[model samples]
Target: MTMTMTMTIAGACPGFRARLLLGGALLAGSALAGPAVAQDMPAPQKDAAPGLTKVASFEHQVTGVTVSKDGRIFVNFPRWTEDTAVSVAELKDGTLTPFPDAEWNGWRNAKKDQVDARNHWVCVQSVVADPKGNLWVLDPAAPAMAAVVKDGPKLVEIDLKTNKPARTIAFDETVAPQVSYLNDVRFSPDGKTAYLTDSGASGALVVVDLDSGKARRLLDGDPTTMPDKSVTVSYDGKPLRRPDGRGVEFAADGLALSPDGKTLYWQAIKGKTLYSLPTDALTGWLTSAVVPSALTDKSLSGKVETVGENGPADGLIISRHDGRMYVTAPEENAVKVRDLTAKGGTPTVLVQDPRLRWPDTFAEAPDGTILFTTSHIQDSAFYKPDAPAALPTELWSIKPGAAEATGSTTAPK
Candidate 1:
C-alpha cells in the first residue's frame, strides 16, 4: 500500500508500511448502499460543533468536496491506501452516483493492464465546481500514491449541464513528475487559469492555462511550497507520527484564491507558514511567449509574500460571503478563518468538534453553508492495520457566521 496521505497511528512495527495520504469525502449512504438514507452510513458525530450537520457518509475514504452553483455536491477519493471502487461521485437524493459515468472511474489497480489509465480516473485527488458552471477534476493518476502512471496525470473539465467531459488537458512528466502528487486546485474567476498544490515527495505550484492547455511549475524546491522542517503536525498536544518515526510531511497541500482572483494562498501540510503571490505575476509570464522555466521560477519566487502562519492544514477556501479565507485545522479537529483585509490577519478559531476527524476539504453551498469532509487520517487503515480498507468518512457543513449558534442536522437531501 502507498502511504501518500491520511489516517491512523501505526507505531513503528515490523511489517509492510505504505503512504499516509490525505483526502476527505461525504454523503448520506454507504458506498455499497443504493439510494441510501442517513441510516446507511455512520450515525451523527457526537459533540460536533453547533450548527454542524452531517450530510453524507461514505464507506470509502474521501478527500475533496465541491458544490456547483446550482447545489450539486461532488467529491473525490484518492487511491492512497486502498484501491477505492469509485474515484469520483455526485450526491443526489442521498445517493452517491459515479460522476460523469462508471466508465471514467472504471480503472482499477488489479486490472491496470486491462484498462487505459490515461482515459480513466486512476486516482482522482480533487474536484471543483467552477463559477462558469463546469466541473473540473484533478487526477494525480498515481495509484497508491506511488509511481506516476505514464500519460495518466491530467485535468478534465465536464459540462455540468450536459454532464459530459468538455475538455481534457493532459500533464506530462515535466509538469507532473513521478515524485509529484498534485493535491488540490483552484481556478481564476473566469476559468482561464488554474492553480494546484503538489503534496508529494517534492512540493511546487502548477499553473495551467485552460484556453491554451499549457501548464508550468512555479516555486519548485522553494521553502514556501516545500514542508517546513520546524513545524510538527500535532494532535492532543503531541506530534502526529507513524510508529516508524515518520511524521506528516505533505507539502503545498492546502490552497485558496481571493474572491477578486488576484491573490493565491497555499501552504505545506508539513509546514505552517502561509504564503501568497499576485495572480497577475503568476499568469502573466505563462501568457508571455517562451520564457525560460528558470527565469520564470526565479521571478515568481521573488514575488512570493509571507501571508501568515497556520498550523499544518489540509483544505483551504476563501468564503464568498465574508471575503475571508477558511482553513481546515486537522490537528485540532477544527476550522479557522483569517481576514485578508487585515494588515497582518491572525486566524481565529471558527469551530471545533471531536467529530471533525482530520477535516479535509471545503465548499460553499448555494445557500451560504460551508461544507467539508472528515478524512479521519489518524484512524484509517493506512496507520491502523485492523482498520477496514473502506474507511468510514462523512461530509459536514455549518452556516458561515460568527453569531450563528445553532443549525440543522436532519440529513440534507
Candidate 2:
C-alpha cells in the first residue's frame, strides 16, 4: 500500500498521540472529500457584495482554474481524493469535457512503465493559459500526494486554437526532485520563462526556459518560500486542524507576475506574509558560475522583499486592467485587492461572502471578468474525515470597479 493510504488508515485510529503525529507528518509532507449537508454548511451571505456571480458548480473539489483569452474556461481537480476522474477539463455549456481527449486522462491506475507519463496527465495541479493563447497544464505526478511517478512530472502546452497538445516538457530530479510539489505557476509577459512554486517537502522556486525546455530550482528552502511554523491558520473562528489534530500547513503557493514581467509575487498557504522579488534575480541564478545546489535566505537577502498582507492567502493574481493584485484571504472568507503601484498601501476587501469557503486560483477573461474557484479546503477530508460525500465546489466571477474602469481588452499573460 502507498504511504498515503497507510496514513489515511492510521489517521482514522483512536490513539491521540499517534494520530496527532501522523496527521502532522501528513500536513508537513503534503497538502482532500465530501457531501450534501448543505444546511450544515455556512449559508451564503445574503448581502454579498455586488458584481459576484456563480459561473459553475462541481461535486468534486476544484482548486485551480484558468480562462483563455477567448473566454474558454478550464479547471483542474487534484487527485487528493479517490474519485478524481478528470485531472484537466474544459467547462463548455455547463459540462466538463476532458481536454485533448479521454485517453490522456486514463492513466490513473496504470502502472508507471505501462503508461506514457510525459504524454498523459497523471495528476494536474494547475492549468494556465499564456498571453499567446496556449494552455499549459502542470502535473506534479504524485497522486494522493504520494510518491512521484517515474518520468511523470511535466508541463504540457496545448494550442487553444487546435485544442491539441503542442509540446510536453518533462522535468527530472534536478528541477522537480522526489520531494518537489509544483503547486502553482505563472508565465512571464514575453512567455519565455515560467515561474512555479514548490510546496512539497521543501519550498523553492522552479524556473523553466520555454525555448530550451531546461528547468532550474532556486531559493530551495528559503525563508520566503518556507512556511512559518509560528503562524497558525484559522477558519470559521477556530484553528484550522484535522480531526487527527494536525494543523493545516502549506508552503510556497500562489504565484503572480507583474505586468512588466519584472516582479514575481508569491506566498505560503500557512503563512501571512507576502513576498516579491525581481524576476532577473531568479533567472540570473541559473547562469551563475557558482550556483549553489540550494539558495539560502542570505543568498537572496537583498533581492527578496516582503509585502504586507491582511492574512493567510491561497491563489493570487494581478489584474492586467488596473495593475492591482488580488489575494484570496480564506481566513476572512473574502478577496482583498492591493494597489501594486502604491507603496505602503494596505489591501482593501474587494468582496466578501460566507460562501467563499477557500478561493484557490484566479483567472482574468478578455471581457474584464475575474474568475476564481472556492474549494472549501478547510472542510475537505484532509481536515474532517467525516466530511460530507457530495460537497459543492463553486467557480465565481466578479467584475471589480478597477477592472470595469479600465475596460481593457488585453489578455492576461
Error of 1 at 287 (Å): 2.4
lDDT, candidate 2, 1-413, per-residue tens: 10211111111112101011112222332110011111111222234346565555676778798877766668887777544666787764324667777777766655553468778878789999998989999999887667787899999999987989999999998778888788999999899999999888788888888988878888888888888897899998899998779887788998999989999989898888889999998887666676556656466646789877646888899988778899998887778888877766568777777778898899887655677899898888788888864455877777786434543122212
Which ten contiguous residues of candidate 2 have the minimum total lDDT? 31-40
Quantify all predictions' global Cα lDDT against the true fold: 0.77, 0.74
TM-score top scorer: 1
| Cα-based lDDT at residue 54, candidate 1 | 66
Q: How far off is residue 281 in model 2, in Å?
A: 0.9
TM-score of each: 0.85, 0.83
